[model samples]
Target: MTWINDIKHTLNKKCAGLAACALVLALAGAPVLAPAQALADVRKADVVYGQAVDARGLSVAQCPSIDAEYAFVMDKDGTVYFERNATSPTQIASITKIMTAVVALDAVASGAATLDSTVTVSAAAAAVGESSADLQEGDTMPLEVALKALLVPSGNDAAVAIAETIGGSEDAFVAAMNAKAAELGCIDTVFENPHGLDDGEFAGDQHSCAADVAKMAQYAMKNDTFRAIVGGGDTAIVVNRADGTKPTIELESTDELMDYYSNAIGIKTGFTALAGPSFAGAANNGDKELYAVVIHSTSEAQRFEDARELFDWVYEHELDYRLANSAQTATMTVNGARTEVPVAAEVPHTEWIDKTVKATLADPEASVRIFDLNGNVSQSLEFDEVTGDVKAGDKVGTVTFKQRNATIATVDLVACEDVAAPDLLEGIGIWWDRLFRGLSGQPQVASAVTLNETPLVVDKTAVAA
Candidate 1:
């Protein structure tokens, strides 16, 4: 509630005479001279996380404090949860390798190269050293192995070799990296070289922001090869030489966060005189995946710690909203059954709802109103038209839950009890009763007898005897 009031106060003070002031107020869920579209788009009545902000805004007040100069957190789907100076251009150091990986993998995806294709280590690449894969000039290895070298050790040499192998030259590869950044909407990123070694002679105007690095990391992680390489930690790679000698090179991941954090999956680490200590980290909590970037932290450990804290805070805030209960029942008519069958969910269903921010579903089946931090829930129930006998636990329908257009859970609706078809005389009697009820405008009563197994046939002749 304070955040809402804070927004109002800030708007009155900071947003005076802004053209979109009314729209900003609307997005803050404040009643003002807001356009219909603004109110409709931003007002998510009750079920939203603490002081939810618009997609473009940050909720720094609601998030954990961190020491990073710039930080950003988002889900795999690009839903922003928290940000601090996320869009400001700053030194990113080896975090640039995330985009380098994206460009190299894109080349592989486009048929310009293959992971198995050979990459020759050039003198320029081998000499441009900071972190090295121990690759010598003229040594060759598969692009896959080169990627392992590049990402695992944060190898500057491997980055240049990969650039040359894929883009024909380092300059051209740098150009491709810039183009890919633009394509990914990384507005605050630029690439001056294949490796982010911009501390001395390599330094220039090259820079990126937390938000842009997150985008690159998200895109690169989508590639299975890239994900495996970054998360591989310590690994051994093989390279071929002109003298017919093959040797194994052991590489340890520079991104050491994975060593301690159980949920830590990937990304990269970076540090330079200008960049300080930085990290792009990712984690998976059940089916929910999140990415966080921390740039210009105090130290190597602090970078990882900053990311861990952000992840911990964000994941802890996630809520499991119940969508379906197996004990709850609904009634539906089925063919040949004596009465309407009681249907219930086959299992209890709940969705991992992120409570740190409000997100929109891509497609919603139905919508419900709520006054909690869980956001709007959309549910849809589909029942199968049935006729005939049914047993308890027989699936008869389905219920699906969604939020912000993303499906959170789905469960099958099942019968709660058995229903049997009436016997010959009973069927006749039921028809007569139905006719009488229709004529009298009275309700038809369901047969009281429940068949445990199968109905028994009656012997009318024997009864007469």
Candidate 2:
């Protein structure tokens, strides 16, 4: 009775294996029964089958409602991941300081000014009210220190002073700002002043689109000094005088994103009766970095809260990165073997990301390509030259998946088992088999033993028509 039970289990196991093979072969469109000698080929097909089965399928990013009238979330390349009135021209308030900093940095890069260069304040710069650095008509500081005052406190005075020092006058500086805007493809942008004030005396309230501000912030991050000043904490700066002495001055950063939020990076904050509270901020976690803007919110806290909510929404929908980690284990075929060898990534997926992406295995030894929703190949994962003697736990390949061309996950493909070289006689036998098949006018590799080429009926199976 025990022997009978063992036989039943064996038959059940065979039935299960055949059922799995049937499903796989059906999807691959081969349709034919897997020949007895084709066991390894069918097993190697698991690599492709595993990927298809484990695919994340289609995903849609569900964005939450932003409290502000205009908002934008983007990558460094200005690829917008989320937007609400992003391209529509509207008030950005003090985020204009991003462009101000950009124009100032460009001037420094062009040798027109240096971080050490002095910003001699004018009556015009000092007189401008609403969030002033309190520059008395003659106060002077280095261009570098002025930047800290401008960005940290969203100082209107510092904006005008940097403009005069770098652009000869605020009008000329505003023109330069517009030119830079055009160069950066800020199609809906226009600048009326170095600061984003409601200059009722000039054109209309100084305005820009959410998308334009995102572009400016992304470009500004390229400057080393800008990155340092923005990412640093509540700071004091020393201004150099001609006599080789330094005057120490302290400043406050109103950017709550930088001051309170742990993940927040350096950027500018702005508010007014007309423009309300607005923020252009960036945050990073692992490989997930984002630049976002929330403009015209009712209060300061609301805009920051909006920034957090928008970012959180973006994070929740990122299952593509998670899916890659799930299927690191797979199988591959050896050239002359009848069984499949297991393979995996030596390193697991550790990047935090969410984007619609796909990967395709071109061939056994060829690299796998990752594609975006636009069907563009965003990244390619390549494997090392793996020979039959590869041992278990050997490093075989590496896969680094990216979103917007930013690496979100890096995994090391590894051998899951040892595959020793075939015996000499076994190699000769394989070569002779290939030679015989080729000489007989068949393929270099013969088809399955069950192929119906012989054209006969047996045991009630089909015969010639």
- In terms of lDDT, the best-performing candidate is 1
What is the C-alpha lDDT profile of model 2 across 161-206, one tens digit per residue?
9999899989999999999999998878888888877645534846
Q: Mind sharing the TM-score for model 1? A: 0.62
lDDT per residue as tens, model 1, 1-465 = 111222333354345467476767767975556555311112212112333354414233333557788888888987777677788899888888888889989988999899999999999988986677889999999999999988887888899999999999889999999999999998878899977877668869999999899999889889999889888778998899878899989776766678789889988988777887889999987757889999888777778888988887676655445443233233433364443322222221111111011111211112232222234566666655433555545565566666555676666655555555455776677677777778988745421211111112222222334
Scored against the true structure, residue 181 in model 2 reaches a CA lDDT of: 95
Give the clash count for each candidate: 9, 3
Highest TM-score model number: 1
Candidate 2 steric clashes? 3
Q: Residue 400 deviation, candidate 1, in Å?
A: 12
- Candidate 2 positional error at 465, Å: 60
In model 2, where do residues sit more than 4 Å from their true spots? 1-62, 77-79, 203-205, 237-249, 319-465
- Steric clash count of candidate 1: 9
All candidates: CA RMSD (Å): 18.8, 23.5
